[model samples]
Target: MKQAQIICPVCEIKISTLELPQGKNAHCPRCDTQLYRGSHKPLRDNLFLALTGLLFLIPCLFFPFVTIRLFNINFSANLVSGSYALMKESSVILGFIVLFCSVLTPLIVFGTVITAHWGLTRQHFTIFKYSLLIFQRLKHWMMLDVFLLGIAIAFFKLSEYATITPKMGLACIFLTQIVTIFLLSRLSVSRYWQRWQSSEQFQFDDVQTHCHHCHLSQPESQSCVRCGFIIHKRKPNSIQKTWAFLITAAILILPANLLYISIFYSNGKRYEDTIFSGVISFVKSGMPEIAFIIFVASIAVPIAKIIGLIYILIGIQFKHVTDYTRRMKIYLFVKWIGKWSILDLYVIAITIALVDRDQILDFLPGPAAIAFAGVVILTMLAAESLDPRLIWDDSASNTPQKESLHEK
Candidate 1:
């Protein structure tokens, strides 16, 4: 029997699927776009990690994440308190966004993954399929990694004026991030889907066209049969759309840095600070690690992302296809870290919520917070708009390969 095949979503080239060796990935021979990766570990192992991460989340919610003492006054915050504080302070939308991304989404993702794994083990096909679908949707919203970076920024900012201490919940959050990353790396959903299909003796039709969004196989059509999203060989004007978002983000990064992020008031003194000021404060306070993180996430990452997107867009526009693999890796890295740029805004939200008193000590949100959030969101959209398969399309012809490796 002929092996199954999938068309590259970005390049629209039909390629045979390969059963990747353990810890290996099959890239398109022409464009070097990663088609699929093999998981070195079993699905059960990923299940365990997901469960472990879920357990760690308990401490992250209840226990103190950080403590700050200023002028003999001490205040501690947990994950829940920040959201509640923001809501209480009338920033309802911001509050919900923080809570959903930091707490609710992570819980949902792990829960869904756990359910899917259980269904897989028990051969509950319906439960497994639906659970996996939900998991795929929730995974993008789980921002614990971004939340942890926010915590680091909060610590650095607080340390500059108060006696700051990392609490047990903070440690737990870090560990949860580690386990989540590990679980995601080991659990290849595509591979598991293929396995389930094999066990069920389900076969996809030999169709040249497939939906990029839903992965639905169908005859050549203009829209996805399942999703109703307009189907295209590649994203419509992918390069132009990416460039627009990237340029917009690049333009916003300046005011995001130059304008004040937050203003602090204490004992009749006022201090307004930008992102760089916070980094400098941390460094001067002997917390070089915190400074480095803030600098990278706030400064380096955003600039690097804009520049990286520009490089990729330029390469695609001009048909300069050298180092396709390296550029693809860069694109992946940019996509992965794009959300972390929101850490500074998150820190401000949490801090504003915590330190809002009349006289003693208080912080006010600044104009830059909105600008910074815009930068993060725009870059994320840019990453989503730019298809990685386009990187390969520049060098390779549109012909579909017939004799590609088969998925096992």
Candidate 2:
């Protein structure tokens, strides 16, 4: 008996009739809509990315991303030094921000990424489960973009006072992050799970619908106008978690500001540089550029990150969006802004390197910097951890689809 074939309503492509698997995908050859379905994605690519990312993570941690040279005096700064300097400067809020992004978050993220990849590659079920959990938890904490921005800001600021030199460690970190990104791009758990199910034809009874460009949804018959892609009714916890983290960050911001951030000791006088003071100091110093950087990194970025997270979360929380395009724009903006908090660390690093040795002009860090750094890193992690599809959930129903014209 010849199998029945269904024609795609929009693309008019002929699809051979087969047992349509739940959570699987089939595409229209012409327009690439979900005409029939199979699995999420292939596991091999995701596994490869996780493994490669892990391998590169080690050097990313151990190496110093930047170096400073001043008046024939040279010193190396690491995560510890950066944090400590902020504490000495009495801007411990800023100090903490530096510490988390540069040190703690990176360490946790690298470890988690590696474990997740290794578990999948070896097919160690127990390890894979644990890795999935770890990936979920630490995914948001890794802040590569922030680290890079810190490096850039530090380079520019330090150059004005001392000759800033990029170190081998910095080079290694840059390369490793590039490799890690490539790896992350390849790894997707949903795809792997789907592939496994396909091989076994497992009857999981999970009715999952996905759209490559549009967010995943319940089998709908419309293409999204924003991305011109089909939509999904459901999406990953990316949006919810993003919103939760953003709220948490917003709540913490009050304490971060209220508490001591960092203390700056210069010329036998001690002054605390709060979020506001940091901005004032730079503006007063006639370094408008540096002041602006500080304002964005320490002030503007954190708040923006929170707001963006909230927008994404809310949209996803109540799927079927009208602002799909706008939400996407906000997510990208949040992603870019999250790194600005690294400014505090670079400034502190420069302060430590420049003002420490001179007997008449000594500088020290404080406590608040540490906490602030934590806020920045954690918030960034929250952003990275979120999935991007929540923005499209609102408009899934009426959105145009390639398959709506013909029904099975």
- Candidate number with greatest TM-score: 1
lDDT of each: 0.75, 0.57
Q: Candidate 2: misplaced stretches above 4 Å?
A: 1-72, 83-100, 103-118, 160-163, 194-200, 203-262, 266-290, 308-336, 349-355, 358-361, 365-408
> Candidate 2, after superposition: displacement of residue 33 in Å?
14
RMSD of each: 4.1, 9.0
lDDT by residue (tens digit), candidate 2, 1-408? 013344443323334445555554555543344444344455555555545555655665555555666557776664356667656745656656556655666566556556655665676655655555565555554566556666665565446556766767666656657865765544454444433233223222222344343222223345532223445343356655666666677777876666655554545676676767766766876778867877877888888787777766766666644766667667777876676675675666555744565543455545555556667767877867776544443454424333321222
Writing each residue's lDDT as its tens digit, candidate 1 over 1-408 gives 135677765556677665556666666555455566655566777778888998999888889878777677777888888778767764665577678878888888888888887887788877777777777666766788888777766765666568887789888988988988887666666656655553124355666776654464556788855445677867788888888898898889999999988788887688888999988887888889988888998899999999999888888778885777678878989988887787776787668755776566887767787678778878988988887877877655667665473343
- Top-lDDT structure, candidate number: 1
- Model 1 ranges off by over 4 Å: 1-25, 30-34, 40-42, 70-73, 115-130, 137-141, 199-207, 210-232, 236-244, 286-289, 314-327, 402-408
Instruction: Score residue 384 of candidate 2 by CA lDDT.
Output: 72
RMSD of 1: 4.1
* Pairs in steric clash, model 1: 17-405
